[model samples]
Target: MTIRVVAKNYVKPEKVQDFLGLCKSLVEVSLKDEGCIDYGLYQELENSGVLTFLEEWKDEKSLDQHLNSSHFKEIFPLLSEYLEKETEVNVYRKTL
Candidate 1:
């Protein structure tokens, strides 16, 4: 079954724009991955520093592959530094 993931990041107020820019490349790369069905980023309308990712994957195994990818490893450190708190990642499956 396809998996849907929502990841919310509370970024440092000053670095919000920078973080968004960084994610642009990450999104591009992720979307090109074989396992990624869809990937995109969004900034909360009310809170500029809050960023969220809406992603869909082919399956849990694919999502696991994505987590272990080189791009993920590279961006994680940068993301960690600018994040105000730990990222909140919620996963789900579609139901008929």
Candidate 2:
């Protein structure tokens, strides 16, 4: 089944641009990975500090591989420091 993942980030005001830049790089690398069906970043219209990622992968194994990927590991620390609040990630399997 296709897996969908959503990650919501509440970035510090001072680190917004830096966070976005990092996200851009992350997205670039993610798109190049095997079984990465889709990946994108979005900012809330009313709240610029809130960033969200919408991603789709071929299956659980693909998603697992993505989580273990070098690109993911390399940028995670940088992304973690910018969060004003804890990040939220949710995964779902598409039905129908």
Candidate 3:
């Protein structure tokens, strides 16, 4: 089954641009990975500090592969430096 992943990040006000730059690199590479159905980043209209990543993967295994990817390993830890709080990530399986 396909899986969808959503990650919400609350960035520090001063770090929003830096956070976006990093995410742009992450998205560019993640989209090229096998089994990555889709990947995108968005910012809340009302809350500029809130950025979200919406992703679709072929399956749990594909998602796992992405999590272990070298780019992810290198970029993810750096994200904490820009965040005001921990990111919130959730995975969902299609129900129908």
Candidate 4:
């Protein structure tokens, strides 16, 4: 099944720029990984501090691989520090 993830993160105002840079690098690397069908990072227009990640993978295994990937490890923990709280993530699988 195709896996979809909606991830939301609220970043500190001071770290927004750094977060963006790291996100760019993370996105670039993730796109090249096996089974990465789609991935994007977007900022909310009404709330610039909020970042949402839209991602799709071939299956649960692919998503697991991505979680263990260096790209994920390198940026996410640093980004987490700047977050207002823990990241919010919603995972879904297509039924139709």
- RMSD of each candidate? 1.0, 1.0, 0.8, 1.2
Question: What tens digits encode model 4's per-residue C-alpha lDDT throughout 22-42?
Answer: 899899999988999999998
Our tally of clashes for model 2 stands at 0
Q: Candidate 4 versus the native: TM-score?
A: 0.92
Task: Output the better candidate (3/4) by TM-score.
Answer: 3
What TM-score against the true fold does each predicted structure earn?
0.93, 0.94, 0.97, 0.92
Question: Weakest 10 consecutive residues, lDDT, candidate 2?
Answer: 76-85
lDDT of 3 by residue, 55-76 (tens): 9999999999999999999999
Alpha-carbon shift of residue 13 in model 1 (angstroms):
1.1
| lDDT tens digits by residue: candidate 1, 11-73 | 999998789888988999999887899999988899988899999999999999999999988
Looking at model 4, residue 89 earns an lDDT score of: 99
Relative to the unseen true structure, what is the C-alpha lDDT of residue 23 in candidate 3, on a scale of 0 to 100?
Answer: 90
Q: State the weakest 10-residue window (summed lDDT) of model 4.
A: 73-82
> What's the lDDT for all of these models?
0.92, 0.92, 0.95, 0.92
Error of 3 at 35 (Å): 0.3
Candidate 4 local distance difference test against the native: 0.92
lDDT of 1 at 94: 98
Which candidate tops TM-score? 3
